[model samples]
Target chain A: MEKTVVIPTDFSIASLNIVKSYVSMQPANARLNIILLHGLHQSDSIRSLLFYSKHRMMEELCSKEFKEACYVLKNKFASQIKTMKSDLFSGFTQSAFNQYTEANNIAEVCLPVLYNPKFKNKNSFDLLPYIKASKLPVEMVGSEVDVPMPEKGKVAELFFNRVSVS
Target chain B: MKMRIQIKTTLILLTAFLSIILMFSGFVYLSVSNYSYEDFYKLLEIRAVTTAKVELDQEGGSQEMIALRNEFFEKLPQEKDRYYRISPGESFKNEAEELGVPISFFNEIVKEGKSEYTKNSMFYKGIRYKSKQGEYVVIASAQNYFELHHSAYLRRTLVFAIIAAFAFSALIALYFSRYVFRPLRKITDRVKEISSENLHLRLDNNSNNDEMSDLIGTFNNMLDRIETSFETQNNFVSNASHELRTPLTAIIGEADVTLSKIRTTDEYIETIKVILDEAETLDRKTKALLFLAQTGFNGKTQKFDKLRIDQLLWDVKETIEKINTNSRIHIDMSLLPENPVKLKIKGNEQLLHLALSNIISNACKYSNNNVVNVSIGASDQNVFIIVKDHGIGIPEKELKYIYDPFFRASNTLKYEGYGIGLPLTRNIIRIHNGEILVSSIVSQGTTVQINLPVGKFEE
Candidate 1:
């Protein structure tokens, strides 16, 4: 059975450790779906609301470093993780948060204990309070190791130079 | 040229400030002068209408009314009044000449009831009044002394302010231009001090993140490349001369010794063989040096075509077979991606062939006829070629100099090579935007890995 786990992300290199923490708790060779959730305030004006697009928001929120970090995580956990996707959460109330989790088919919520997301945009908000208020079971994972900020050099080392002599 | 930049900046600022200042001063002067002219005309018109009311309406003018008018109204400077009565269809030609007024002035009053005109500093007005008497024309003339004085004062003040503003703006523009160009001045002086002997010196970039700092950074990076190439060229020239001399010296010494003493036929044959061996070494070194120099240029004068790396590898193996008949070489292609397009790379085929052949043949030659395994593989972005040789490997200390021209491993003294092959191959690979890495354990083997970016197929 495939289980979907929702992990909060700030699109930072450090936030990717949540995936590592969650994957460590799963059974060996168990297929799982991972959702990286970022919280943002939705446009309230009528015109903007009518023209809202999730893909454009993802492009703005997911930076080059964040995208590479996601690729590295997915590749490293390809066997146990079936799919990893990014999602935007724009809810202000606890009831809306409950609906979003159910709609995404999230079976469990994994929150980082040490990580506080640094919002990249002005409209970004912290989703921890809404997730805590929801009625779903939440697992607080500790991710203490701080990944060094991935520069161009670090990203190249991860993407290329993975030569295995087999 | 440098001073012209500063002067140009100053001129631009001055022109902008001057235009704005001139416009403002001109507006003030024009408005004040217009108000003074209108005020003086209104004073004359009011006087003319009042004279008509007091003189014509009073019928020869009551003594008490005249006295009251004289007491209430202060006389203007050079004020004069004239009254004339004329019937319908009559022109005041004689009266106008006598009063120094044009005939049009009187005609205008008769037609419009009132009119005002000015000549020099004198103001005039005429009003037509009718009662029991025939139509009457009352003319009022005055010299507007107060208005003339006010206008003169305004003109003087405006000219003074404009002169002062011109000087102030010139000073400010000059100072601002100097402040903006101080950094540029320092940069020029520092640049003037640098020469080929001081290529290691770099401009300081301590300022904030701005265009000036960006320029300095770019300049320093350029210097870095220049210094590296200069050192390489200097090293190549010195090493080439020394390597060439060693072979010629050996051949010359053998020839000289053979000619100095007569010997047996066998001895003469041995001497000739030694001389011939040294000559052959000289010939090989010259050809290798020539090839190295020819391939030193990047991409220019070379034709690049889309080449399948696997096919190129096969061609290299075949070429090595023609050169070294006893060489043992095996190619492993299992690691290659299923898509043949991944193996395609845009490169000069001859250069690639030379580069790959150099490595493969060296591997077979160094390993003493042992099997050399060559593997071809590809990832999404790059194609990989790995050549493994079981031979007396390079010393760890000397591995760094392998890319230097005329640099050879200390353990490979017995092998016949001029040490130009590896550097030439590296240059060819770099032209293709590829990287080569060598790792080895002394006395065990050496593994060489080359990666080239994949090419796009033509549409």
Candidate 2:
């Protein structure tokens, strides 16, 4: 059976690296489904722009970035790749992720550890405790290096061995 | 040697402020120090993980790892970060072992997967990482030089701040003490200027209504009492001298006239009689004065016995009747309690008799009719004696002064009195812990009520 995996992103390059590192580490015979979850954190300016023409505003804000990420993910992985967006302007990201994972039959979650020098004492995201408290298996990928393109074979073997044991 | 009230209060306030400031500063210092330690430990943990990633990875050789290590070293050169790689089976030869951290501490880190602690002011964080290479324990440590320097600087600044604060507090306290006691100083100066000649001088009390004003008011009230007492003493001395000299002069004149010429037996007898009358008047006045003096003294040595108040009044009536056969003094026992104990009172019997006789005799002498009625009654706590007379009562205004020695009512000038009776009677009653109340209307009547505490019965 093909297993669906969820990756929550903040549209940062660090988050994209985590997905790339995780996907490249899968085995050859492993059948997997990948979901890229984006939570929309709309500012007042974006909200006003959306209020005028939501369809056009969304296309203008997300078209280029989303397309490039999708193209990269598709080219890197043989598994099915899907994209999802949630209106997180009203609620917490953890709740939105939980709801998306449940609806999409997500078997596991992958997150990135991104270091912020400005906030060395604070967490980059407040989602780990929520994910740990949930009934889902979770993995963390380190984003210390800025690798534009990672070796697919190396990442694939690494992730395949790690996920297979658990 | 003795601190003024303002100084004392200012010192107390300053002490309280300093105490609060010290507590708050201590809490702040502790919190900042704790946060600094936490941040240091986090940095050490990150360094440990990054070192493991760069050094232990098989795919990334020494070249890339060396470059990464250089980048890490260049970024945080001031950190003075150190690392010790220990193999579990080895003899534990490392710089960390040399740093004197117990070998058991590293063992605990390996067992628990990770541990962080501070030893000798140096933060130590150890992590056990397993890679394809081998099982390795990475112990990272650094002297928190930045935190230590920051704390030291904070300590120096706090010391200076505390000293400055104390000096400022002393200055403020001096100013506050002076400001608060300004009114008291004025009052003291004014009081010091006043002597016997300026007894009429008073403190200025028209200031803001506060405790200081209350103090000034109390002082002025005390001065008023003292001045009144002084005037009364002066008046008493003058009046007593005049009263004593009058009878003495009359007796001297009679004796001189009798001796100036030889007289017949009848004439001599008449002169002798005149002298005797003046002598008797002088003797009575002297005796009354002596008794008044005794009662005015502290009654600690006075003998007290429980005596029935009703029986004492009857004795007074009998004595007055014997002195003057025409005096009609009646003792009314209608309100007397059936229980004889209720009428009992603690007093010096002789003094009580003298007091009652004075009131009864005065009533008989001043009444239109020579009739004085004395009633005896009792309450739960006291015995009451009411002496009522249809006399030429004192004037309303003069009633207050009736208890003043030698103070006579305007209407009573026609009556023969040295004006010592009421004051003497009042003193006698007060020594026995009793109150005497007199109410009268001119040409109508006068009533004197004496209330004395009921005596406790002894077994």
Candidate 3:
């Protein structure tokens, strides 16, 4: 069965390149799909525009932000995960991933921190417990600012010699 | 005489040289020839008139009254003689001889009263006779003449013609020199062909010394400099590529291995550790490589300081002792100054220590059962340090590459090293304007020598 990852967020496309790099390195047959869902930040943006809304456009706005992020990821990927509603999808947010991990007794990748800087210093935020308990490997998505992979042989060796992991 | 430069140049100068000599010689020759002909004619005219006056004064005004006419009658200027009689009363015994006197000669002086003469001598009885009035003959002769007696002038014009031909030929020689030097076209063509790859090929500058030789020399020197820079650039790129490879491979390998399979906690941690380890190694190697590359680019930072020799060595010795309790490294400091060897050279002490420590550590590590020896002493010009080890010494060929960054000898692979230690040590020493040398033979032993400049160590 394909391994499913839930990318919960008020998603931004800033990290799309990193996702693309990951997908390229994957095995051809690997069935890795992302479950993207917008969290409460979508609600916050929606509530801010509530005065002018003639209809229930808040749901539409949240869905739009979610869909756009998914579209960017899909263009770089072979196939993508279709969004499941709140009952099955667990609303997309860091809080949702935490809830999903605890409830399902499975590891959920901690991605919510990308949405807010205010909670960054707090080590006890949503992903820490899941990371500690999870048996599977967790890959923190690299930012676009990370250096590109170099050519093989000497170039590869030189990069390794000079810029090893911190 | 040894020709001076101006003299040599004067001899070789083409312009106005032969022209001056030709003009002077031709002027002298023409003046002398003209003066001699003029003097001959004036003397002839003066003598002729004087002789006629003397005769007229002596013998009254007629030919019959002249003594020469009476003497000629007493002797009778006849056919046996080769002289002519000009008197009308004179008698001739031989009528044939009388007819032999040329009518042209008689008419020349008597009938026409003209001083004209034929070039051929007249014959009396088939024998040639001289005419006394030959001076009366007039001929336009000599190429250019002053007055009478210039018959040579018309025939001598050939001399002037020959001279003019010679001078014209000299002028042609000068023109030939100007025309033949058309080689500047070839010289410039070859010069334009020069490039970095063929900088060693220079202009064939074997021609005469002039602006062209100097120009070729300057271009050849410029090519030398360009060639050096080209080599430096080539070396930089080659070294840079070689240095960049390690870190990248580790990053990919680590990430790829982790991405391969699902693992338990311990296995996952172990895998991540390898990845992280490789990353760290890459970082270190990259830093070293960058430092080495940049150092090589401009120059090594020698910026030295006054280092307390004994104190620094003691500190190093103490530090090494702490790292390994049983390492066989013996410090023999008997020759050092009692008060701390206060040799404050302008140098980088920390880097110097790094270099020394690397050397000392290697000696200790490579030694067998024997203890490695370290010494510090000084001469008037330079400080000396010897690090000698009786260990698995390096082979002759391997010793050459010790100072090259990342060049690990094939034999030294058993010992853990990236081979950067010696290169780093060498660089540090080099920055201090110092030299480091190693001499080793298989199983025999190894000795390292260090030489530092005396007081100009600040560089």
Find the candidate with the highest DockQ and give its number: 1
Per-residue lDDT value at B110 in model 3: 45
Q: Which tens-of-lDDT digit does each residue in B1-459 have in candidate 3?
A: 776444344335533555665576678667876686555344333333433433323444555545554464232111122233445554333532454444554444444533322222221121121234432222111112232234356336646765675667556655665554546667768977876667767778886798878877887766754554454344555544543444456567667877788768987788677667656545654655555445542343434457666566676676456444567677655334322322445565555665676788777767743687776544344555667777778887777767655677666667755565676667567657677867776675666766554454433
Candidate 3 error regions (>4 Å): A1-166, B1-302, B318-326, B337-342, B368-370, B456-459
Give each prediction's DockQ, rounded to 2 decimals: 0.06, 0.00, 0.00
Candidate 1 residue pairs in backbone clash: none
Q: Considering every candidate listed, which one attains the maximal lDDT?
A: 1
Clashes of each: 0, 5, 48
Cα distance off (Å), candidate 3, residue B344:
3.2
lDDT of 1 by residue, B1-459 (tens): 366899999999999999998899999988877887788778877787777777777755567767876998899899988789967777899998988879999999989998888887788888887756668888889998756687788888888998999999999999999999998999889988989898878899999999999988988877865665554466676546654675577677777887898878998898788777667656765665555455454446556789899999998798577456799898975355556776789987766876788899889989997998887766556677878778888788888989866788989989988776687678678778888888776777878878788897754
Q: Quick one: best TM-score, which candidate?
A: 1
- At residue A128, what lDDT does model 3 achieve? 38
Looking at candidate 1, what is the lDDT of residue A76?
52
CA lDDT, every prediction? Answer: 0.76, 0.66, 0.49
The sequence of per-residue lDDT tens digits that candidate 3 reaches over residues A116-159 is: 31221221133334344544455555332333221111101111
lDDT of 2 by residue, A31-133 (tens): 6676655434344576675676545544543434334334434433534333433222223656766675687787998876552312111212444455676
Task: Give the least accurate 10-residue stretch of model 2 chain A, judged by summed lDDT.
Answer: A157-166
With candidate 3 superimposed using the best TM-score fit, by how many Å does residue A116's alpha carbon deviate from the native?
Answer: 86
